[model samples]
Target: MRVLYCGDVVGRSGREVVIEKVPELRKSLKLDFVVVNGENAASGFGITEKITNSFYESGVDCIVLGNHSFDQKEIMNIMSSDKKLIRPVNYPEGTPGRGAAVFKTARGKSILIIQAMGRVFMDPLDDPFAAVDRLLNGNRLGSQHDFILVDLHAEATSEKMAMGHFCDGRASAVVGSHQHVPTADAMIFPGGTAYQTDAGMCGDYHSVIGMQKDEPLRRFTRKIPGGRFTPALGAATLCGILIETNDETGLATSIEPIRIGGHLKPTL
Candidate 1:
């Protein structure tokens, strides 16, 4: 199975880039499935139902949320009805949306995509490892599902890497998001699971982590609350990873980092 997991989509730049690039990538890469982290798609805060629908229409099979999962309150209205929309698994028991779901490709193969939020330097939610363990233990990778993808929306790189190693040999790929900066390390683990510290944000990189530089810089250098942080209006660099899993073992055979447009060096 070939899958592409995009990083957090910040704002208009991120949304435009994704809407423009996904269809082309899907055809060129021959992707069987696509998932995107959309926690920051709404003016750099949260995503809405409209944005989610745009993604689906543009070829996104599933959408995952992170720390700002509910920033756009309107999403909760359709959270229960939208099977393709996923939130952090560790979010309390009564969280609006699901954390994991099974999606079937055109070829009739099933892939389980799970999203978990890390507690280290993040929200004091449930233990991510424990939450993931329950799901991983319940699902038989090669038998019940053709592939399993875990998206750890975390702040600490250590936590992300730990999750990757923890789920080694069990999931087809373990990718991280929320940092908004693409890491150079993209490799398959010893156990055949693909790992990347961060897939980066599909937003303009010219600013401070996809935000307009003025506010972030003002807060950083002067340490005073000036105004709300907004997304950079420049063209965005779509960042993500493409993973190809073995059909029989349901393990990753290859992993590749992708960066296109904007300031980052193009990987294509």
Candidate 2:
């Protein structure tokens, strides 16, 4: 199975870029499933139902959320009906949306998508390692599903790498998000899991992460909020990780960082 896991989609520019380029990339790569982190798909905050649907229409099979999952209040109700949309598994039990789901690829292969948020340097939440253990043990991927992909939403690179090692051999791929800067360490782990510390953001690279640079710079310099942060208007890139998994064992055979379009050089 070939799976593509996109990084965080910042705002309008991110969404527009994905909608415009994902379809062609999907076709050219012959992707079996596409999972995207859409926590910031709306406007550098939270995802809306409309934007989530747009991701689906643009060839995304599953949409994962992070700390900003609930920033958009409207998603609280819409998530109840959208099974493809997922929030962090480490969130408390009463969270609105699910953290994991199974999606069938066009070729009929069952792909399990799981989203988990790290607690270090992030909002206090349940233990991500424990949450992932419970989910995987409950689902029994090798027997119940053909492929398993985990999105480790985190701020610290160490935590993301730790989680990837923890899930090695069990998950087909483990990719990180939230920092917005793409890392160069995309490779298949010794135990068969494809891993990357960060898959980067799908928004403009010309700004701070995906927001306008001025506000972030101001906050850093002045230590005060002067104005609301807005999404950068420059052209965006679709950044992600591409993994090819073994058909029988459901383990990753190869992994590559993918960056296409906009100011970033294409990486595959």
Candidate 3:
């Protein structure tokens, strides 16, 4: 199973980048499945039903959310109905939406996608490891599911790394999000799981983590609010991680970091 998991989509630049490049990447890379974090897709807050629809039309197989998963009030309505869109599994009980799902790829293989939010530096939630473990209890990685992908939307790298190791042989890939900056590390773990500390954001890198620079800068220096935070209008760099898993073992055989367009252009 070949999967491309994109980072957080922040506002218009992020959305546009995915709409523009995903189709091309899908064909060129021969991706079987695509997972994108749409936590910040709607004006840098939470994603709406329309944005989710657009992403699906652009070939996104599944969408994941993070701490900002509920910023958009409309999400409460659409999430229950949209199986492709999942919220954090650890977001307490009866959160109105799914936290994990089993999806069939174009090739008709079943893949399990789970999204969990870290507790550190984030809203308090259930123990993510325990939450995911309950689902994986009887579910074998290669047999019950062709592949398993975990999106650990976290703030701490330490926590992300621990989760990767915890699910090393169980999951095919474990990717991180929410820090919004691509990390240099992208490798297949010793246990065959492809791991990355963060997949970064699918938005402009010219500003602070895809947001307009002015307000963040002003707040940092003056400690005062000047204007509202908005997405940067500059060209965006679609950041993500591509993992190719073994067909038999359902483990990652190769992994690579992807950064395209914007100031941080890639040769690939």
Candidate 4:
């Protein structure tokens, strides 16, 4: 199975790149499944219903959310309607949307996607470790599910790495998000699971984590909010990780980093 995991989609540039490239990538990369982090898809804040559907039409298999999951007030309704849209598993119980889901490919192969947010320097949520363990407990990866993708939407590198090691051999891939900056560590673990500290953002890199540089620079240098942060309209660099996994073993055989379009050197 070949899966492509895209990091946070920040805004217009991010959405546009994904919409334009995914279909082409699906064919060129021979991708069987695609997951995108869309927390910041709507103007660098949260995702909207129309934006979500646009992504689906453009070839996204599933969409994941982070701390900014509910920024768009209407997403709550879409979550109840769309099972392919996932929230963080560690969110408090009774949260409207599901945190994980089992989706299938065109060939009927099962792929389980579970998202968990870390507590370090983040919102107070349930134990991410326990949430991940609960999902992987008896759901044997190779036997029960053809592939398993664990998305650690975290801020700290240690937390993301810990999750990868914790789910080693249990999941097909463990990737990080939220920082919107791709890391150099893209490798398959000894247990065969693919890992990357961050897949980066599909937005203009000339800005601060996808937002326009002005406000961020002002806040950083002046220590005061002068204006709202907006998405950078410049050309974007789509960033993500692609993994090739063994079908029978349901473990990653290879891992590759992807960065293309604007700013960052192309890694397609």
Candidate 5:
């Protein structure tokens, strides 16, 4: 199974780029499934139902959310009916949307997608490790799924890496989000799970992690909110990881970082 996990999509620019490129990329790459982080897909805040549907129309099989999942109040209601969208699993039991789901790819293969949040430098929530274990033991093992992808929406790189190692032999791939800066490390673990510390943001690379550089710079240097952060209008790069998993075991065989367009150098 070949899966493409895209990094966080920021604001209008990010969505526009995906809408423009993904269809062609899917056909040319022979992709089996595509998962995108939609935490910032609206206006660098939360996702909206319309934006989520737009992503689906653009060939995204599963949409993953992070800390900003509920930033848009309407999503609470939309999540109740939308099975294709997922929020963090570590939230309380009665959270609006599901944290994990089984989706059928365009080719009809079953794929399990999970979204998990990290504890370090994040909201105090339920144990993510425990949540993942429960989900796998209950929904994944016996299900005739051919591919499994985990979106570790986290702030800490160490925590994300730990999660990847914990699920090494169980999941096909573990990709991180939220940091917005793509990491260089993309490798398959000994247990066959593909892992990357951060998949980066599909936004303008010329700015500060997709936001206008001036605001963050001012906040850090002067310790004051001089202005609101805005999405950079420059060309955006779609950053992500591509993983090829074994058909029988659903474990990764190869993994590589994917960075295309914008200011960053292209990667395979």
Candidate 6:
């Protein structure tokens, strides 16, 4: 199984790049599945049904959410209905959407996608490790599912790497998001699981982490909020990781970083 996990999509530029590239990538790479983090898709706050549909139409198979999962109120209306959409698993019990789902590819192979949020310097959610363990316990890789991918939406690199190691040999890949900056470290773990500290944001890198520089700079240097942070409207760099998993073992055989357009140096 080959899967492409895109980083957080921020606002219009991010969405545009993803929409423009997913189809071409799916064909050129022979991708079986495409998952995108849409937490910041709605003007860098949250995702909406319309935007999610656009992504689906453009060849995205599933979409994941992070800390800002519910910034857009309308998400709740379609959360349960949209099986392709998932939120952080560690969220409270009553959260509308699910944290994990098993989706099949055109070849009828199962792929389990699980998402969890870390607590360190982040929302005081339930234990992410325990939350993910419960899901992995029942769905064994190479048995119940052909592949398993865990998206640890976290703030701390340590937390992300810990999750990767914790799920080693169990999941096909463990990738991080939310930092908005791509890390250089992309490698397969000793246990055969692919790992990356972060896949980076799919938005203009010229701004401060995909936001217009003025407000972030104001809050940083002046220590005051002049205005709300806005998404940078410049050309975006689509960032993500591509992983190919062994069919019989359900472990990653290769992992590669992907960066296209915008300011970051291109890689594939």
RMSD to the hidden true structure, all candidates: 0.7, 1.0, 0.9, 0.7, 1.3, 0.5
Lowest-sum lDDT 10-residue window in model 3: 131-140
Give per-model TM-scores: 0.99, 0.97, 0.98, 0.99, 0.96, 0.99
Write model 6 residue lDDT over 1-268, tens digit each, in one string: 9999999999999999999999999999999999999999999999999999999999999999999999999998999989999999999999899999999899999999999999999999999999999998989999899999999999999999999999999999999999999999999999999999999999999999999999999999989899899999999999999999999999999999999999999998
List the global CA lDDT of all models: 0.95, 0.90, 0.92, 0.94, 0.88, 0.96
Residue-level lDDT tens digits of model 3 in 1-268 = 7899999999999999998999999999999999999999999999999999999999999999988889999888888999999999998787889999998887889999999999999888999999878877767898899899989999999999999998989999999999999998898889899999999999999999889999999999999998899999889999989999889999999999988998996835
Residue 160's lDDT in candidate 2: 96
Please write out the lDDT profile of model 1 over residues 1-268, one tens digit for every residue: 9999999998999999999999999999999999999999999998999999999999999999999988888988988899999999999988788999999999999999999999989989999999999999999889999999999999999999999999999999999999999898999999999999999999999999999999988988999989899899998999999999999999999999999999999996
Q: Comparing 2 and 3 by lDDT, which wins?
A: 3
lDDT of 4: 0.94
Worst 10 residues of 1 by lDDT: 70-79
Clash number for model 2? 0
Candidates 4 and 5 compared by TM-score, better number: 4
Q: Write the per-residue lDDT of candidate 2 for residues 113-192, one digit (tens) a residue.
A: 99999988999999999999987887755677889988999999999999999999889888999999999998898988
State the lDDT at 187 in candidate 6.
95
After the best TM-score superposition of candidate 5, give how far the Cα of residue 3 lies from its true spot, in angstroms: 0.8
Clash count, one per candidate: 0, 0, 0, 0, 0, 0
- Evaluated at residue 256, the lDDT of candidate 1 is 93
Candidate 6 ranges beyond 4 A from true positions: none
Candidate 2 lDDT (Cα, 0 to 1): 0.90
- What RMSD value applies to candidate 4? 0.7
Worst 10 residues of 4 by lDDT: 75-84
